[model samples]
Target: MPQLILSPWFFILVVSWVIFLTIIPSKVMNFYFNNEPETASTHKPKTHAWDWTWH
Candidate 1:
């Protein structure tokens, strides 16, 4: 294996992909499925404003 293959960023990318594929689907599906029956949604959306300092 190449030295770059063992880097922290690579590990983070792989871990993120694994979690995205294995875990995120069920959670997202459950959210939509649980909300399907409701005429009024119980979940509230948060207002997110970007800080110029981060940019």
Candidate 2:
């Protein structure tokens, strides 16, 4: 059987594709599924921004 020589460009291309498919999607999903609801729920609060000054 022939062997596939892994060049530097091939490594870079694979790493980029992995990051594109995996990391970006997880971040987007986390934001959409987790953070979106938290932010949306807190958005309607009557609290003022100055509330943090007491802390």
Candidate 3:
């Protein structure tokens, strides 16, 4: 309307979507809640659940 609300590419596309919602969703949720939480890869058995049973 009023020159597209005083353009300049509409205030640089609203400050680039407000810095893409304030910097990429808090750095992707702080690296997905700072990892190491899937039972630390199944209570550490060769990194991801192993230790079979048979003998």
- Candidate 3, residues 1-55, lDDT tens digits: the string is 6665666887898999998999988887776454465534455445567677774
Q: Model 2 over residues 1-55: C-alpha lDDT tens digits? A: 2346667768989999999999999888765444344434555657655556656
lDDT for model 3, please: 0.75
Candidate 1 TM-score to native: 0.44
Highest TM-score scorer: 1
For each candidate in turn, the TM-score is 0.44, 0.43, 0.27
For candidate 1, lDDT tens digit of each residue in 1-55? 5666668888898999999999999888766444456487898999998789955
Cα deviation at 17, candidate 1, in Å, is 0.4
**Regions of model 1 farther than 4 Å from truth:** 1-6, 32-55
Superposition error at 25 for model 1 (Å)? 0.5
lDDT of each: 0.81, 0.73, 0.75
lDDT of 2: 0.73
Error in Å for residue 43 of model 1: 36
Candidate 1 has an lDDT of: 0.81
The candidate scoring highest on lDDT is 1
Query: RMSD to native for every prediction?
Result: 15.1, 9.8, 9.1
Ranking by TM-score: 1, 2, 3
